[model samples]
Each structure stands twice: as C-alpha cells, then as structure tokens.
Target: MPVSASYRWSPFCVDGVTTVAVKTLKENAAEVEKKDLLSELEVMKSLDPHVNVVRFLGCCTDKDPIFVIIEYVNRGKLQTYLRNSRAERHYGNTHGKSNILTSGDLTSFMYQVAKGMDYLTSRGIIHRDLAARNILITDDHTCKVADFGFARDVVTSKIYERKSEGKLPIRWMATESLYDNIFSVKSDIWSFGILMWEIVTLGSTPYPGISAADVMRKVRDGYRLEKPEHCRRELYNIMYYCWSSDSNERPTFLEVVQMLDKLLHTEMDYIELERFPDHNYYNIVNLSGEKL
Candidate 1:
C-alpha cells in the first residue's frame, strides 16, 4: 500500500484461500492524510498494470473508513524477505525448499525491479521513493514495485522540485537531489543502485551508523557506497554507473534494464549469498537521528 508511516492497515483473507491488502482511513481522519492516500491512488490509476508493478484494485470512499484495495503480496516487504533468506543461509536450514533465494534469484529480483522502473519512467512517473522496503515479494518470488506515495508524474515538467519537504530519503537520494530538492528519472536510478546494494547485502542498512545529515554531506563530497563483499566487480561497476556525481552520467532505466539483462544471462553469478559476511541487521527507527 502507498501510505505514510502513520497509516494503519492490515491484510485479510478472502474465503480462507485468497488474501488482499487494504489501507483504511476513517472519514473523520485529517484531510491531509486522506489527501495523501487519494493522491497515491491517482498515481496508481494513471499507469497501466505491469507484472513487476503492484496491481491496484477497487476502492470504497463512500463510507466511514475509506478503503483502498490492492493485490496482496504473500511474502510482504522485499527487505524482510531478503533478511529471512539471509537468516536461512546463516543457520544452514534451507532444506526442502524448492525456491530458496539464490544469487540468481537476487539478480532476477533486481532485473524485475529495473523492468518495473523502466515502465514507470517511460510513462514519465518518477518514484521518489524506490527502496527495498517499498518493494514487495510474492509467493512465486516475483518482485513488484509498490508504494507510490512519493511518486510524481513529470510528464509535462520532466522534473519535480520539492516545494516543501517533511522527510526525504537521504541515503538513497542522488547527489543533485541531496544538494538540491530537484528530482528526475535519473535520481530514481540513483536510488535503484542503493536498492541493488540492499538486495546484495540482504537488507543491510545503507551507510550504516551514519546520520542522515552526514550521509548527505558525505555523498555531496563524492563518497559513494562501498560494494558488498559478495558483490561482483562488474555488478558493482553498474552500481557505480548509477551513482555518478553528475545526473546526466547516470544510465537511463532502459539502459539499466539492458545492463542487468546481460548480467542475468551470463553463466557467472554476479552475487554470491553464501559468501555474505555475518552482520547484525541495523534497524533505524528514526532517520533524523544522530546515527542510522
């Protein structure tokens, strides 16, 4: 669901065989919150459905608790799913599983996300927030881009400028986006690199132990995120391509898709999960805190 952190929601089963996710808001809720949800709904409605993008269902507005329905993803957030897979690898308990997440699976996930983003960018929609937590995994292991609350349609403007900022994604943001409030498809690509890092690292927090302010400062000073120990040089290079200091130097979503496609078709693995080092999951409850 494309909701803010304060939005309360839950999943319900239909006939005990199917499930659907619902985002509900009472009629008496603040106007800003309701407008946020409705705004996301409009963005979702503007695009054609894709296999890699979450499907939007119907909504109920003429009621006390307005409901926005969306296709339910069984595996939930990609970050949590990746973390669980890492746990399985850590404990050596990945048995009897036909679909244990492999290096290939991770590559496929990234490829799928790229394809989804490609579709969105082609439609002139910039997903201001593109990260692991905003993506969802399905029972069949397909990655779908979700949560369009921060998305904007730049079809006419070709760019989005932040008029008023409440909270911005600092760590995943591009250099221009961090330095200035400007956003574009290239900025989304920059965030994609960070998402690639999350997938390779099994949801490890980016710029671990650094404050959001420090992240902005370091990024502005030409400090890029280090490649994961298990990430291949070629894949890391692609990530570097996305994190270019100049937005114009960054690859387009289509170019990114093509690059990832080539990597996927290669016999060599780009990421080796077995080689991933053991590390504690850094949970950042507050992004504005001194340290993430």
Candidate 2:
C-alpha cells in the first residue's frame, strides 16, 4: 500500500486472511463525492475474478463509514520495490550495498504488467490510473494491477464531465487527457509509457523538479521523459513510440505486449550485457526455468 502521506484512507489486513484498503471521503466531501465513488465500486463488482486485476471482495456502507474490501497483496505496492531498488543503487555505487533486482528483473516485471494491461483492455476495461503505486507485486514478484478507484467502463459516454474534474496527478495523465480533455484506451497507453519509464528509472519521479504545467507545455512541444542510462535502445524506442504526440501513432496494448515479448526473447550481446553489468539474465527466468 502507498504511504499515508496525503492519503485519507488507511490499509489494514482483515481477519488474518486478507488485506483490504479503505478510503473514507472527508466528511465535508462525502455527500458530494459519494455517487462517483459508488460508481467506481459498481464497476469493480462487474470486473471481479480476473487474475490480473485486483479482486473486490465486498464493501461496507453504514451509518458513519463507507469502505471497500479488496484482495490483500502482501508484497506491497510496486513503488516500494522501485524506491528500494533506487536507494540500493545509490548506496551500492557509493557504499557497496547490494542490488535488489537487475535490469533483467525490471524487464520481467514490465512484461507481467503489459500482460495485465492486455487482459484488461481485452475485457473492454481501461485502467485510468496505471501508476507505480497502483501496481501490487506478490512476494514471489508477480504483478497485479490494483487501485481501480479511478477506472471506468470504456464504452460509457460522458462518464466524466469537465466540471466534475478533480485534481489529477498531472504527470501520470496523458497529453490528450491534460490538454484535449479527451480520454480513451489511448490515454491509458500514455500512462503505460510513463510507467515503463518508472520501471527503467527505478521509480524516479516523472518531470523531476518541473511543475505539472511545465510538463504539459513540454509535452505540447513534443518533449517526453528521457531514457535512463541503463535502458536498452529497443526499450526506449518502445516507450517513445507509446508517448507519440499523436495518440493514433501509439501501439495498441496487444501490440505493446507483442513488442515486449519479442524484446524479452532477443539475446543481448556481450557488450550490451557488460554495459548493464548489474543486469542478470536469470532474473527473467521463471520458477519452472522458462523465459518469462
């Protein structure tokens, strides 16, 4: 679960058998936001039982409290792992700390996330909030896309009105979402591109030291997040293509999956491996010894 920094909700394990996160609207905002929250909950109910997406166990709406129960992923949020890896890298370079995962581990994680997205998109559902903190990993390092609080039915018309807009994290939102006020499966693709960048950079903040407005301006000018030093050219190409200025230029989730699948299978040259010396090919090996 994400840290309770500015979050109003708190996560707790339930009955020693499940982990559930509860988000309580502020008293003043509850009356106004209840409908939207309920809408999301209903959508969750409709999409339950998918292995890639988080399960909605049940909910509670009583006199003074409202809560939704979800599957408990014990390994915590993907952001936690990314942050830990980044810290380890920093310390490892300066003080000889060990690395948690190499580049190959990152690649496997990305492949799993793409598979999850492909599954959701196939079901006609788009995960509007596809951020690092929203993805949960298992203790064995398998990924599940969680936090569907912002997800919506893809075919629903006018589900979000301009006036009803709340503050978006901005950085994670697509260019069309930020500028054209248009959102579609393509918008989710944009978020996925940023997510890929996060995986490569180990959860480095997008547009670091830049304001959201500036990011919008830069995106409008065709600027995108830069590729990290350790990233492969093929991977960078994929990310760049995903964030193309024209949404139509971006590949479909299925296409994204195919491209990543290909890259994951391609063998790296000795120079390539040495350039990313910390990367371990074994990290991509599944428990059964098959390539992921």
Candidate 3:
C-alpha cells in the first residue's frame, strides 16, 4: 500500500457549467490501490445524497488512471479551514471577509458532522477514519464528511476486525481498536470526540507534543484529552462521553446529533470559537498516518 495518497483536485466542467472534482489514482498504482479505489467507488455509489455527506458525481474506470469524481468543496479540508481561520485572527488579517467563527458556527459544524455520521451508520457504513482532515468545508461553511478509503460496510456483521497490519490513527482510535484492531460504529464515535477537540482547538493535532507510543500507553491507561481553553464545560462533557472505555457506553450518532441540536438552540453557548486566543497553537498535521 502507498504510504500516502490523496484525491487530486481536478476541477472540470462536466456539463460545461457545473464543475466537479476528480479523484485520480497514481499512474503506477499497485493492484491493492486499484482495489481500494474500486471499493471506495462502490461505497460512494451505494450512499444516498445527504447535506452533510460529500456527493459522488461520477467516475471513469476505463482509463489507466481511474477517476472518482465528487462534488467540489471550495473551502477545502475542514482542518485547513480551521487553521487558516486561526491564522486570520492571529495576524488581524482584515483584507477580506473574516473567517473568525462564532459559537453558533462551531456548534453547527459539530451538529453537521453528527448528522452525517448518523446517515452513514444508518447505511451500515463505518467510516474507519473520522477526523477533521477527512471532512471538507464548503464556501458557505457547511461541513461534509469525505474520504472513504478506510470505510467498510457492516450490514451483515456489526463488527469488522482488521487482520492486516497497517497505519492506524492511534490518537483518535478507541480502546478496543487500539488493543485488538477491532473497528465499529462505536470506534467512529470515539474518533468523533477527537474531531470535536480538533474543531475547538482550531485543528490542533491530537496528543500534541506526545509521541505515538506514549499516546497508546496513555489512552490505554484511561487518560483522556483535557478540554480546550475555549471549549465549554458542557461541550467538553459531551466529548468525554464519546471517549467512554466501554464501547457500549458511547452514545449513538443519532443521540449525538440530538445533543448537539439541543445545544445549538439553547440560549447558552456551548462553545465560543471567537474566544480562541490570538496566539493559537493548533496546526495541521500529516494525515498519512506516517507519523504514527
């Protein structure tokens, strides 16, 4: 398997007016890579269109470099968006429209992700890797779940075990996944908690300053990430809930959606993204899992 591969942003006007992104595989991609791309295509084709999920446009498999076309998200990765927003605020860049987010904006992002995850779980799909980097942000700030390379269908069996060893998101992984290579909707929920942390921290890499080996040891020892300075206690509590050691204890995506919805409508702000310190420390990290 390739150490790192990303969908190329090849925007073309398919209809001479409407543009789309094409995910192209490398010219010399291995057989396993081709199979993975095909698997991703199958999964995307099976999914129904949802506001919070990236829309699959079409594909081209007859050619040497297979193409998996998808809807174009102008703002790009949510991780990059958040980091840029932080930079904008830090440097007082008022040249154009500000990207500084409000409490409602942040809450809406969390709610959108939960809704997307709910839809995927309903379709019996497990987004093995759920993080900010895998999510895309539209120009309107709508968050959509993207990247299905690690996704699996669990309609028949509720659990999926990894028999092959490869790169894993240890920092965002659940306890069972870390220890036994087991993956399920519950593990995705745990990763969602990490995603929430990323949102609040402006895309800070999880377990910042900690080594991968240390992250595994600490997570196994019942250690959880502390709440961010700008994160509210209530929101932090919700994140903590997602990190429950027992997978069964974690709330379903629907429940998470409900919680976030309620939080969004409430008078009290669950989090204040505008309060993020000017001297922010969060930065985008490699999503290739090579660091791990």
Q: Which candidate achieves the best lDDT against the true structure?
A: 3
Q: Given candidate 2, what's the lDDT at residue 87? A: 60
**Candidate 3 global TM-score:** 0.93
Q: Model 3: per-residue lDDT, tens digit, 77-171?
A: 88888888777767776577676877788889999999999999999999888988889988888999998878888888978997766677788
Best by TM-score: 3
Report the alpha-carbon TM-score of model 1 versus the true structure: 0.91
**Model 1, runs deviating above 4 Å:** 1-3, 13-18, 26-30, 94-99, 289-292
TM-scores of all predicted structures:
0.91, 0.81, 0.93
Off by over 4 Å in 2: 2-16, 26-29, 92-99, 156-162, 269-292
lDDT, candidates in the order shown: 0.83, 0.69, 0.84
* Higher-lDDT candidate of 1 and 3: 3
For candidate 2, the lDDT comes to: 0.69
Worst 10 residues of 2 by lDDT: 282-291
